[model samples]
Target: MKKRLSLALLPVLMPLLHACTTVGPDYHVPAHAAVHAPQANGPLLGTKHPAVSLAPVPDAWWRLYDDPKLDKLVRESLTANTDLRVAAANLRRAIAMYHEVEADNLPQASVSAATARTQISGESFLMKEKIPVFSIGDVGFSVSYLVDFFGKLERADEAALASAEASQAALDMARVGVVAETVRAYVQGCAATHEYEVAERQLALQERGVDIARKMVAAGRGQPVDALRAQAQAETLRASLPHFKAEQEKAAYRLAVMLGKPPAALPAAEAECHEEPRLRQAIPVGDGAALLKRRPDVRQAERELASATAKIGVATADLYPSVSIGASAGLTGLLSDLGTGQTAHWALGPMLTWNLPTNGVRPRIHRMEAGADAALANFDGVVHKALQETQSALSAYTKELERNLALRAARDNASEAARQNRLLYQAGRAPYLSSLDADRTLAGSDAAVAASDSEVAIDQINLFLALGGGWQNSPDVTK
Candidate 1:
């Protein structure tokens, strides 16, 4: 009899199973996203220079400088930076949420046991009768499986998976940021130290000039005003030393914090470095196609769009009825007869749930559609922003390279002019004031060169950051 009953239900269930259809618009990569990639996937506009190569960008770009201290600092920051830690935590949470939604596709089972005292009363026979209470025991096991006749759970799983991917991308983005910032801090500290050294040398030269002016005045061969002018120049140069020192200290403090140390726990060796690290070869900047694929922000935006699109299906699924197959067998009786066959019972069937008041469902679907639209727009914006940043960084780096070359040439010319003026002064063929002017020009030129060098180093780091390297091998925090 039970077999016949089960056979009778199969025909009714088969049709519902075969009719399952996912109810929302399917997701595809938006057409506008690929449109933003440069034509022919050619080299970026700013990459047509000797300083930039079309080779693939390095995953660990900071190592290009071959500075052991910088390498160690970047490694430490990647592991210990607080921002990365937070992002890792978020990724873990997202993964867990995805798993939770994924579980809906499997059978849900539950076991329950209970004991209660019950009383029976009889009063409808026209005679009142007292009833005794007795203990009852019940034990049951049940399982239910959602039919997913409308692909509701499937869409939920899709949305959750996309969200998890977005979280992973966000973590990657954070890794890139931490690495770039660590390199920037180290480079800036070293550059400031170099500037400080240059200024100290220039101040020493100026002090000697002041001494020479004083000596000439004492010998009644130079005016007192000449000594005063020389003294004033030396004081001005002395004023700049503190600014460079402050810059070095600030960079050190920033670096220490990034390494998960206190601000006062400065990296002493890094602070003492007087030369900023430089790359020995052209920067490897792959074409636009690779950049679009490599950038984490772009990936994040794309995943968010996918998630939003899935949510539309989720909302649409709400408009239909939910169906599930349920089965249970249990024994229920007085304590004295709980295990008897007479107390056995069983039930097997399908359950249908329909939220009849669906006036709000369509509105929710519209809202989800709007959200997807916004996500699509955001994705396009992120792609364009990534390209813009890369192009701008490349342009700035190349222009700074040109400017640096000009400044270096000016520095060399000023150095030669100062040397000639000093020789002429010693031979009594040039006035002391003329020599002083040449020395001042040389000092100014040296400072300008130092400042320009720092700018170039900073620009290189920025370009690498825009290239979105250094996160390819980021640690798996979700584990």
Candidate 2:
């Protein structure tokens, strides 16, 4: 009897062994093929600037700055920044969601227990007379699995996995932003401090000039107007010191917030940085192809496009019938006879479900199709924007470098000229006014150089940001 029963079930179980075909269009990375080729008309690589290179970027690009404090701050922020924490949480949520979708591919099993009291009517088939209340107890175990005849589950899993990947890319993007912003704030703080020191020196020199002008006037050798002019110049230079001081304080507060602390809190070393950060080495930014591959936003958009494509397959599979295999084993007897052999019962069979075309089905497919179209467009737009930002950053960085170099030379000449004019005036070979004018020019040149130096560092940071450098250590997502 067992052999015959097993033979009878063979036909019903045969289809379960066959692989189901995946339905609908398979996903391809939209527009990625075009990005692989180097365009001759692409933005010019900065060969003219000695601080620029075509070498591949380092994994820890910030280390190239050679600032240990900066490196430490970046590491700390990576671990504690609120934005990164949020992004990481989102990624975890996506991973959990993916697992939830994947669980649908496995068999579902459940167990249940119940107790009920009921009375049958006198007119019921089991009751020839008035019936009293009766109590019944039951327990059962059931297992069911939806067979993927058209790959609906597979497509759903694919979409879910893609979403997880996109979330990971978003997390990486957040890291890049935080690192860049932290570096910018640190640099700004240092530059502002340096500017303040320079302003103080200029103010002292102007005050000395004012004292000299008053002495000359008291000795009947200089005009009162000259002394007034000297005092006014000293006050003008004094006015700028407060602005730099404010900027310095603001930078410190920004750094504190970026490190995930209160705005008023800051590390002592970071707060006391009074010298501008400088990079002595060239930046190794690889070609445009590598840039396109490295940017997280581009990766995220590509993943989204893939997800939208997978969803179309999921929707398409709904057009076909669904099949499920189910089985149950249970006991049915009087409460006192639950353990007896006579209480055993079992069942197994295939179940089919089909929903005929409804008015809403085609519209739902259309909505999915529209979503896919939007994703494709968005991916294309992201690729183009990434390239644009990279080119723009490169242009700004190179031009700022050139300007910084020019300002350095100009400052040196201005300093020497001021010193010579002062000596010549004291020796009676040049006028006092000439000396004052030279000193004023020197102060302006010094301020310009300081500002340019800060700008160059910021532009360097921007270039790296545009290249998406901070996420190199991130784990690769499984597509």
Clashes of each: 0, 0
Q: In model 2, what lDDT does residue 232 have?
A: 85
Candidate 1 global Cα RMSD: 2.7
Q: Taking the tens digit of each residue's C-alpha lDDT, what string does model 2 give over 1-479?
A: 54566567667556644746898689986444445445722534664567788778787888898889888888878877888888888999999999999999999999988777777688867767887777766889999999898899999999999999999999999989998999989989999998899899989998988998888789877779878888988999999988998999899898888889998667566667888667767888887777777889989998998899899889888887788878899987667677688888887776667777694666777888899999988887887788878788999989987888899999999999999998886676776788889989999999998888888888988998988988867433322
Clashing pairs in 2: none
Q: In model 1, which runs have C-alpha deviations exceeding 4 angstroms?
A: 1-14, 34-40, 117-130, 357-359
- The alpha-carbon root-mean-square deviation between model 2 and the true structure, to one decimal in Å, is 3.6
Candidate 1, position 142, lDDT: 96
Q: How accurate is candidate 2 locally (lDDT)?
A: 0.83
Superposed Cα deviation of residue 346, candidate 1 (Å): 2.3
Stretches off by above 4 angstroms in model 2 are 1-19, 31-37, 40-44, 120-130, 332-344, 427-431, 474-479
Extract clashing residue pairs from model 1. none
Per-residue lDDT value at 460 in model 2: 85
| TM-score leader | 1
